[model samples]
Target: MSKQFAFTAEQLKSFRENGYAGPFDAYDQNEMKETYKKLRAEIFDRSHAIYDLEHSSLLAGYDRHLDIDFFSRHIMRRQILDKVEGILGPNLLCWRSEMFPKYPGDEGTDWHQADTFGHASGAPQVVWPMNTDFGGAITVWTAVTDADKENGCLRFIPGTHEEMHYDETKEMKYSPEQVNKLEKNGMKSGFFGYDYRNLQKDPSWVPDDANAVSMEMKAGQFVIFWSTLMHASWPNTSSNRTRLGFTARYVPTSVRIYPDTDVINEYGSKLSLDKYGVVLVSGQDEYKHNRRLLKNARGLEFATALDELETA
Candidate 1:
């Protein structure tokens, strides 16, 4: 496998310290634009989508990589997998992917961290081994369109991944009516339909935005970060431009995904995991804790470095 996009020693060191790394180049501007155009066309065609939900539902964007060939290939890209392997080891599995679109006048995402990813749903979505107390997926977020402060760029607080500020077990009321209406520290933000502040360990404490750094990226650039990092985004304050981001969440093969849950209930929608399966993007899965898929819903096989080597 080519090590062209693998994280350097310095980059890995910085990632270990800061809990995040890179707005690395994945696709050129023209390629990204063309991909975006094709994605727009395919997004509405939910024939192969795993979830049966209305297009307007917030949960509609979940796990498209399972059905979309482009996304299936995207999650297996060397640029992304190599960096993820550097952190999570060679045995990697992509369990989830979500589409984040910030239309004009849309409120920014609330500042929050997800360890078990159960803030919205009452049950834990992912659980690490009993030996490890720390658990959170590595998220690779790619900018599908140009993102800036005006168009809702991502913001992160470095070195915040180790500690848990919010309790995932805490129940957060989903209130879609409150979207774009709530303001925090003079900034308009909300966690999709739910208020993330409800899950805070300390109800009186607030995030220190003074230390937060904005990640403004060009089209096709991707950033890797821990899912436990305290992160959010700016409101899309632009008159017309909309910010689009795609995030793929990865964890080592040993982690148990969706333990004891066949149905996912979040964002006021319910989804059955009957067709859900994690993609083994790199290496081998000896633990086999979760269902693994070799091909996407479109019948296109997911290519990995090992697969390429065997074929070559």
Candidate 2:
């Protein structure tokens, strides 16, 4: 797989050691922070409430980041997007991005899986000839507030991304309801009833030895990694601070779209993979319709903005 990308020997080696790298601080830091402050106000607003999933003080995937103005375009910058093409080649899709905010005392555990919820499709790449170039999809997350152990930073297992998955079976999966309970109540609610293969010792999903590390980036810094990276976060325990973040996912053109017919939003329309560029990126003439992204991307680029940030 390393041969497929242009990453130097060091990057390939480090990726093998940590599964991912660089909460790349590519943009101007002050602008990044200012942008996030504005977005946060919009996300937590009680009225719009489209992003508030804490039905009763728990589970808040609401007011998700995709609807935000700054991040969507920022995530697709050529400086960043070009690297995917450099590594995985032309034609790409914005699979999905997430707002994985770990607020103070907001305890939750995101189960590890290669693709979005174990592949939007029900099959694995090993059993079927389904080659999921999406697993290599890049997700960039910038911390709006400083994130550390006290505020539930992310944890990752080294070299795990290179390993093959165990055979999929009912004995090794969690139900939607069960995962909900875990989020609403915390891991103390209990572990998933299924048998997870290649299990490790870290509750955060990183390994027990030097194989694990917490992502303690500053407010303006961010990290980007493949979807298959083994990662998780802890309960936020700070006094009165909230850890906010904006994240997005990008994939090379070779991946297939796992179209979903499920209707999730108030619009009652089917949220298919088509809504994303996946339907476009995977096609032979993908860029024939690529104007949508190129049009919206006017002046975005990676520049000295990150240097103005207060590194502490």
Candidate 3:
């Protein structure tokens, strides 16, 4: 890993205190725009996608890195891996990647935090070892388009990653018809198809947004944060602009992903795990608790952090 891309001591301290870090540059604006054009077309082609679903479904955005060449390389970029290594140590596994697009008049995402990532499926998706103190994955969110308040940029309440505000074991009813029709605190918001408030530890409690910080970023910039942080987004009020984000989730090799599960049931869709596997982004996986994919679905071998360093 290049020392130039690694987080400095001051930045690491801030990450620990704020539960998030950076809007660091990854690609130039023109490069991102060109990549976005290709991504839009590649995303629509689901012939090789692991999950069988329509483009209209929210679950259609899940795990494209396993099939798309761009995403496969995007998840392994040395610029990203170096920063992620600073937080999660040397060995890392990218278990999940999702595409988030907010069009005009789209409702903002609900204020929620994911620990086990089972608020909708009613089953734990990722489980840390019993001896570990943390439970959530380190999520690296990259802006595929310019993201701002008008285009549904992300919002975060600092220092909230340590506590669980919402219980994942709690069931949240998924209603596809209710999407983009719900409102919270006068702002249009909803959690895909389900109301995230349903999983709140305290039903009457509401998220205090006074201290929330907006993470506005230009295209190609990325931020890293714990999945347990209290976070949400502003509604895309623009008439023509769209906000798009790509999130790659990482955890230490010791973590077990999708323990005791074969199929994923969420967002009114069912996906088979027969072809699903996590990518080893950095170092060696000594614990091998989850299935590992040496290459993408298209047969292109993934370039690991170790591979990049050796070649450099």
Candidate 4:
């Protein structure tokens, strides 16, 4: 089953150890730009999602219903699904999807895990838009525009995916609460500057080497990563040009949705997955995609394998 494009044992090992993968370029830029321009105006409404200024959570937020728009409605469209099936396996379900845009000079987002809102199911947070083999949600981060360190690209930690999340006493949902919580826990927000202002830095953190290497992708490149990969974005210090990226999550059917608790805030959010007119992967799907993906997928760390790469 291992194909040339499938993930290598070393790549899998790295993903297992590092918690994240890729700076790999997944698609052509010109076409992606064209597709992005169309989808942005059509699906996302070109409107900024209002946030809970204090907590930063989306107030009302964008809908994850794929049926609302053509672009979103087909999250498992062949091109993407084929690749996903290759990685995670046949049985799959969507976790959620959202548009993330960092306006010029904007402080992107904070470093955090995805499941602060729920409990760990197979492995929570590490599933996939591709396949959640690692138990975390798989997120396909498609960049609509250039994502560089200057305009706030993503940062990830290696080898931190296995850490279970509990006692998130600091995962506050409002600004005041977050501030108070940070103060009480003695956490600092001083690592980088957002719009020229230094913000708070997290106390306990992720894989130490995650940020030392990062993706500087041009518009159109999509980076697929695990939700458990401790990831963050840099502040957009550029006076112009915005950074636009969106993420979609895919989960395996085997993992159950964690029951809702007030601790998560979403009152009655059930997996409610049956709602998708057609389940992308009806628990019955073989998840053959994981093996398929394993066959072709290459790990970023494997770049060191080629003697030419080292000498160049």
Whole-model lDDT values for every prediction: 0.91, 0.49, 0.92, 0.49
Off by over 4 Å in 4: 1-5, 8-10, 24-26, 44-70, 77-83, 119-134, 165-171, 176-211, 258-312
Superposed model 3: Cα runs more than 4 Å off:
305-312
Write candidate 3's Cα lDDT for 1-312 as tens digits. 365699999999999999999899999988999999999999999889988774467788899999999999999887898999999999999999999999999999999999999888899999999988998999999999999999999999999999998988988888989989999878899999899999999999888888999999999999999999999999999999999999999999999999999999899877899999999998889998999998899987888744755787
Residue-pair clashes per candidate, as listed? 0, 10, 0, 40
lDDT of 4 by residue, 55-100 (tens): 3333122333333343343454444554555567666665466667
Model 3 compared with the native: what TM-score?
0.96
lDDT of 1 by residue, 1-312 (tens): 667778899999999999999899888988999999999979889999988884366787899998888898899888888888899999989999999999999999989999999888899999999989569999999999999999999999999999989999998998888989989878899998889999999999989888999999999999999999999999999999999999999999999999999999888878889999998888888998898877788888888634856877
RMSD of each: 1.7, 8.8, 2.0, 11.7
The TM-scores, one per candidate, come to 0.96, 0.64, 0.96, 0.62
Q: In candidate 4, residue 73 scores what lDDT?
A: 36
Best by lDDT: 3
> Which lDDT tens digits does candidate 2 get at residues 1-312?
232324566865675566677665655667766777687676665452223332332224322333444654556554455444454555555645556665555653443545433332233321111554334456667676777878777777656666534222223343434432453223422123222432333334433335566788787777766656766666677877777766656655444434333223211122322223321221133333231232122233212122223342
